[model samples]
Each structure stands twice: as structure tokens, then as C-alpha cells.
Target chain A: MKTLIKNAVCLIILLTAVIVNGSGQEYVKLERSRNLQLNNTSAGQEISINVTDEYNYLRIKVEGQFTMGSLLIELIDPSGNISRNFTIEAGGVNTSDIRADRAGAVSGQMQKAFRNPAEGYWQVRITPRKATGSLRIYSLQIYNPRTDLIELEQIEKDTDEHIG
Target chain B: MNISVRAPISKKSIAALVPFLLVSVSTSLAQHKITVDIETDTTIWAPVAYLSLIPDFNYLNTISYNHIIEQSGISKEGLYEFSTEYLPEEEHLYRVHFSKKGDPPASLILGGRDHNHFFLFAERNSNISVTVKSGNRFINDLIFQGYSPNKALQGINTMLEALDSIDQNGNIVNREYAIEAIYEDIKTYADTCSFPLPSLYALYNINYAKDYDNNPAFYRRYLHKWRSQKSLYFREFRSSIRGEIKPSWLIVIIAGSVMLSIILTMYLYSRLKKKNNKNPLSELTIQERKVFNLLKQGKSNKEIAEECSVSVSTIKSHVNSIYSKLDVRSRRDILDIEY
Candidate 1:
């Protein structure tokens, strides 16, 4: 049978080049990353994260300058409840997508993903439902996934150029 | 005439269906009473209390509980009622809140930080009560005795928490003109609040899509003075805040006043075509209009060829044909034409 159909087309091109080089060598196990500078005052601010059972995911990424106010950004869990919240206003960002920067203030990012998330402490409050601003935590990170999957848009462009 | 039926009833018709299901559950627990005293500290809040109705006021920060409707629990002297005989007999907007019972299945208890929910108006023969005092701040020491638009919605949430504590104590040195003069005293207390559902909950706590484009005639005189008050939150504030108050700076000021009146009508039609080409010498040649009236009488193209009998090289060819038909440059701009 003609060399077994040329060794089955050379073993299907070496198993499609080892599944496209193992999905272009994806990786993520970061576990924690910071870059904080927070001060969204007016009696508001809380950020704790201890989430153990080996991280699953959690991002934060704010950036602000402020021309007015309104902040919010919850997350809670580990049983204090709210597992996701965002606001960041001056008349914008109530459910993500803000991007303005170049000194025009706003920048957003809020994330949560975990099938097993609840492992002890995990807070991230930051509240200021209007007036009191400047919260540039460019990255909070905490990662997990391994067998190929690390995309929150390439870790938000390598944690905003490794903290701009 | 298909009339088939099946029979299994007999124990004296199931003992006559338990007193008609306890008289329809005690006439639906006597049609509504929403109690709630709430002190709950099951190690930091949650003996359970939910409620929800919120079909408007943009679902007040809905993180999901797809409008809950009911949940009770509390009782070891913390009270808690809410069955609200299937709500909806007009005045709606309810929401009660309190979480922490290991929330995972539909969580959201929003009201910003530890303010975990309050809102109320209620109906379906409301009896309401709501005390919630234990360590204060449950929406700032909640009180409300039997709904009168929840005490003018707790005095418009304590004048919007004193206008967010005067924009968090930077005490307004023109914080956008003192937040539009405290949103015109909260739209004059939602135009004299005597309950049109707490003046639509004090104009949805004065954020109404960021001050409805800075005063859309006070939201069109609050939708024509509450257009004969019907509800679902004033028909979703008359169909979603009435045509989004045309904002983008009023379309960049009506496209910058139609591009400055189309650039001032092409600069007043090019100054009325340069004042109709500043004397077109009536489109010329009556020997260039007698050599442009003897070169506007200052003469000299050999005295305008001895007063227009022509040839001083034909009056310099009628002064270069009246300087190329009045777009003049000399004869001192053709004797400064006023025609």
C-alpha cells in the first residue's frame, strides 16, 4: 500500500505541527501582579485578595484623572456577595469599555471568572458614587489557566506596558 | 363534542381540597403587608430579605434577580414580611435587599457599598412598615411607616445624601456651578413633592441620565406635570426619558448653527457679488460707456481722448475696457465706484 500512504502523510504533518506549536506557546500562571496607586477618596476604598485554591482569574485595571466623579467597582465574593460591579463615571462606563486617556481621564477594566473562585479573602470595593477621583491601578492580575489560554487581550497589553 | 374526562377524586373529593386551600392561603395573607424590621447580623447581614419589583428607574443597577418579587426569612425578632399579594395595583418600584447568605445564585444587592438596597413605593393595598435600624446605615437608618411614598422617599434620600456630601466636601467652588445649584434644589423637590410616587422618586434621585442634558425644560416640565399620572414609573418616564434630550452639545449647537448659516450665506453672497461687480459700467461698450464717463471725469487718457470722441489710442482702449469690466485696479480704482 505504497508505504502505508506515505506513513499517513507523514503522520498528518506531525500532527499539524504539534497543534500549531501548542497554540503558539500559550501560558498563564501569574498568580498575582500589582501596580496600584489608589485614592478615590470620599470615604471609599477596600481591596483585599487572597483567593487561593490556585487562582482562576480576576483582573481590575482602572486608570483615572477625573473631571468629575462617580466610581463604584465592586467584586466582593468569598461570600460577602457581589461578584462583579463597575461604574467609573463622569458620564460613562457603567458596564465596561471606557478608554479615554491622553489625559482626558477615563480607563476601565473589570473582570471575574472562576468556577471555583471562593477561597477565603477577596474584596476590591472602591466606592465613591460621585466625586473624589484618581484610581490608577493599572493591573491587579491574579491568573491561572495553562494548557493554552491567556488572552484578556494579551493580558491587557502586557499589563498596560508593564504599568505604562 | 369531544368531552372526555378522567376521575381520581374521592376521599370526599380529597376532603374538599383542604378548606379551599386554606381559603386561598388566607386571602393571600390578607392582600399585602410588607413588614421588615431587620437587624440581621448573621455574622454581617443575611437572614434573607429580597422583594424586588423594579421595572423602571432603569432597574436600579440590576446585576440580576430578574426582578425577584419575593423572599422573606428574617424572624428571630428581626421580623421580615413581604408576600405582597402579587404586587402591581399601580404604585410600583420596590426593592429591599440584604445579602451575604452565601450569595452565588443571582446575587446583586447594589446601592453602593454598604447601602445594600432600600427603595420603596409599593401598592397592591400596601400596608408597609420597614424599620431596619440595628447599627444604622441600612440606607441611612431606614424608617418608613406605611408608605406615603416611603416618606417622600426618605426626603429624597436625605436630599441625595446632602448632594453627595457637597460633592464629598470639596464644598463646591463651582463644582459645575454647585452641581447645577444642587440640581435646582432637587428640581424644586421634584416640583413640590406630594407624592406622584415621591415625585417619581425625586426624579430618580436626580441623575436622570446625567441631568437630562442639563435641564430639558425640567424634563419637559416633568413630562407635562406627570401627564395625568399613570404608573410603570410614569410610563418609563414617558418612554425612556423622552427622546434622549438631543445632547451632543445639542448636536454641536445645531451643527454650529448650520455651519454659521452656511458661512453666513457664503459671506453674504460674496458681498452681493462684490456689490454687483462694483459698477459693471452697465456691462460696458457704448464706447465703453463714453469711456467710463470720461474716466470718471478726472480725464487724462489724453483727456479721455478729448472728451470721448475716441482715439487717443481709442481712449487707451476705453481704459483697458473699464479695467477689465470693473474688477478695477486704477483710474484710482475707476474713481472709487459707488455704483
Candidate 2:
């Protein structure tokens, strides 16, 4: 009877640890992952990835300097579902889809369910319909339910291979 | 022998023949005096007559006769002094009689000769003539004709003509009665004539201006006064014309248009206000309100599912239902509702 109880306690602790570890995974961060430098003449550009889990979440922070026109950010999920598609404009401190006639910085976030979107491949597409001057994106991040250990290890190995 | 018989009857025969011849001669030449003479300074003339016998003393004793004879005056001792006054001159009639005691009581008509008797006569054979001086016969004739502007103007014209004739010729040759007649005509015309404004203005301006020539002082003063008076007259005439109020068709049309516009504006405003007051949101159900409130609060499908203890798929169905009820699509439309 004593052995059974001790075993039961050990099993409960292990299960609790697994649940806590799964639930508390670190959010995925993409820090200037795409070395994109948009100038006055650059066209539309896109960055995308396939998210396997339906319960995963995504958070994107876009920072850029654009002169004239607006920057459109669109999220296209795997199941052909669109979510949190919006346009960020220049020249104002607040997040506005429409800006006045001047050059300035813009930053905003968009979140959505990963299960279904209006398009395949979890995507972030930036379109500058009338961008003038230089447009440089400083940061962009995507949040998911998966743990960061595997992704960080994979990024380190790719960097070492590129160096060799 | 014949001569001796004739001498014997001579005294008686002579006596009878002398008386017979004297009686016949005296009867043939017998005469009586019945003369009448009008004694007045006024030039009014009329016929005079005295009746010696009454045809019926009781029925016609107080006889009243309207003598409208043509001539009037007196005659005496075979000399006739007829009134020189003309037919249309002063002609008046009078009733006369023997008013004295112990005299023959007979009615007489005296004065202006008309259509009746012309002379006074007594029952006894008498020699008589009537003599009358001229009176104001011209004025009397005009008055008897009645007051008329045309007749009065004619009289004035006649007097002016006479004056012109007298001025041209240095003669008292025209009868005194004619001079007197003209004077009387002028007086009567002056009394009856009423001058109109146009004629009076012309006369006043002409006569008033004639007094001064070299120095325009009088004219200046008179012009100022006359201008004021003329302006006053025109103002009075204008007021008289304007004071006459008559209804105009334009007045009725304007009044009716104002009234109709007011009524139409009030009716349309009332209808619009009534329609706006009856909102469709008042018919919304509790479930619909909950969904709508959450939508307005900007909750995602997962947040709404957790709050309502339902699956995310169930929340999607509720969102669709809310959209149909609110008649809107997309999350951006939630803020556009009036309520």
C-alpha cells in the first residue's frame, strides 16, 4: 500500500511538470530575421512559415520608416483563412491606417488563430503602393505554442554551417 | 208874303236851333283825364292799369291779374313817357286799387308790362298816358332767367363788349339805359360766376406778377409762396387718390403662398421627427443584445467563446446571427450604429 502511494505521488509530480512546461513555453521571437532593406523603388515583399498546431498564436511587431503612401500587413494562415490584415500609415504617433502628407515611422501588432486563414502558409506580406524615400524594418516577431529550444538549436547550427 | 210869315216865327226858331247846334259841338269834343306816371329812381319798368267797372262785383271784386306785358311806364296829357328800359330789363308787377274813402273802389294793376293790360282806364271818358323811368331792369331780367354759369358768362361778355365800345368811342351816345344795363349785367355776372382752380391760378399769377418788373423782389417772394401752395395742392390730390383702397389680386396670391409654405414645412418636419423617434433597435432580443455588446466591445471569437462557456465554433455562429440581426457585416461596422 505504501509503495503504491509513493508511486502515485511521483507520477502526479511528473505529469504536473510536463503540463506546466508545456503551458509556459517562451513566445517565438523573430528579430530582424529577414534582411530586407526597402528603398524608394522597392516593390511588395513577403515573409511566411507553416504553423503545424491549430492552437498556436502569432504576434507581429512591425517597425519601419516610410515616406508617402501606406504599408499594408497581411496574415495568411494555412487553411486559406485571413486574419488581422491591416494597413499602417506614416506621419502620426498613433496607429492609423491613413497618414497625412509627410515622412515618418509606423509600428503596430496583429494576432490571429493559426488553425485556419484565408490563405496557405502563415504569411506576413508588406506592400508599399506609393512608398517614397527609404523603408527599413527594425523588428518583426511571431508567437507560437511550440517550445523555443528546438528552433534556437536549429538557428545556431545553420549559422555555423554558413560560417564554415 | 213869305217874308212877312218868316219874320213873325223867327225868335223861337233861332232860340231852338242855337241850343241844338251848341249841344252837338260840345258832345263831339268832350274829354276826361286818366293819366298814370311811375315816380321812382330805380329803372324797373312795368305796365299800369285801373279798372272802373267790375263785371261781377261779388265773384271777381278782389281780382288778381298777373300782367306779363312787354312795355311799362306812364303817359300824361297826350304825352307818352314810356320806360326806356329794354324788354329783358327789370320788369316787376304790382297790384293797385282805389284805397281812398269816398272813391271808386276798383282794382288796378300797376308796374312792368307783361302779356296783360298796358294802360290805366276809368269808366268816364278821360285822356291818360303812363310815364315810367328805367329801373335796374337788366339785373332783374337776369335773375328771373335763373342762375346758370353759361348765362352768367354771357352776361359778363356782353358787359365787357359794352365797356370796349365805350372805351373806343368818346360818346355818351349809347342810351343811358344801355349803360345802366351793362353795369347791372356785370354785377349779376360777378355774383353768379364761380371760377375754377386752373383759371383762378392763371389769373392770380398774371395779375400778381404785373405789379413789379425791374426788381424781382416781389416775384421772388410770390414764387416761394406760390410754390408751397402748389405743392400742398398736389399733395392733397395724391392723398385723395392713394386713400382709395381697392383689393388687388397680387395681395391675395402672396398671402396664400405664405400660408401654404408654412403648412407644408410643418407637416414634413412632423413626419420626419416621428419616423426618427421610432428606432428598430427597441425590438432586439436579449441574446442579440449580448452578442452585439460584445461585438461593440471588440472581443475576438476565442474571448467570446471563453466568456460564454462555448466552443469557438459556437461563437462564430452567434456572430453571424448578430450580424444578420444588426444588418451589418465586418467588425468595423459595429461603431456606426446610432443607438
TM-score of each: 0.33, 0.20
Residue lDDT tens for model 1, A1-164: 99999999999999999976765455454535444444445667676777665544444433343434656676676658554465544432222211233222333344433423446787777776554445544224344354123454465456546754
Whole-model Cα lDDT per candidate? Answer: 0.63, 0.42
Give model 2's clash tally. Answer: 33
Q: Please give the range of 10 consecutive residues that has the lowest summed lDDT in model 2 chain B.
A: B107-116
Candidate 2 Cα outliers beyond 4 Å, as residue runs: A1-15, A18-32, A51-68, A77-82, A92-103, A116-119, A130-164, B1-339
Score chain B of each candidate by TM-score.
0.32, 0.23
Best by DockQ: 1
Interface RMSD for candidates 1 onward, in order: 18.1, 70.6
Alpha-carbon DockQ of candidate 2: 0.00
lDDT of 2 at B142: 19
Instruction: lDDT for model 1, please.
Output: 0.63
Name the regions of candidate 1 deviating beyond 4 angstroms.
A1-71, A74-83, A86-113, A116-164, B1-32, B35-79, B82-89, B98-247, B250-267, B270-278, B282-339
lDDT tens string, model 2, B137-213? 22222121122232333344345445434422223245334544565455334323453222122222122222233
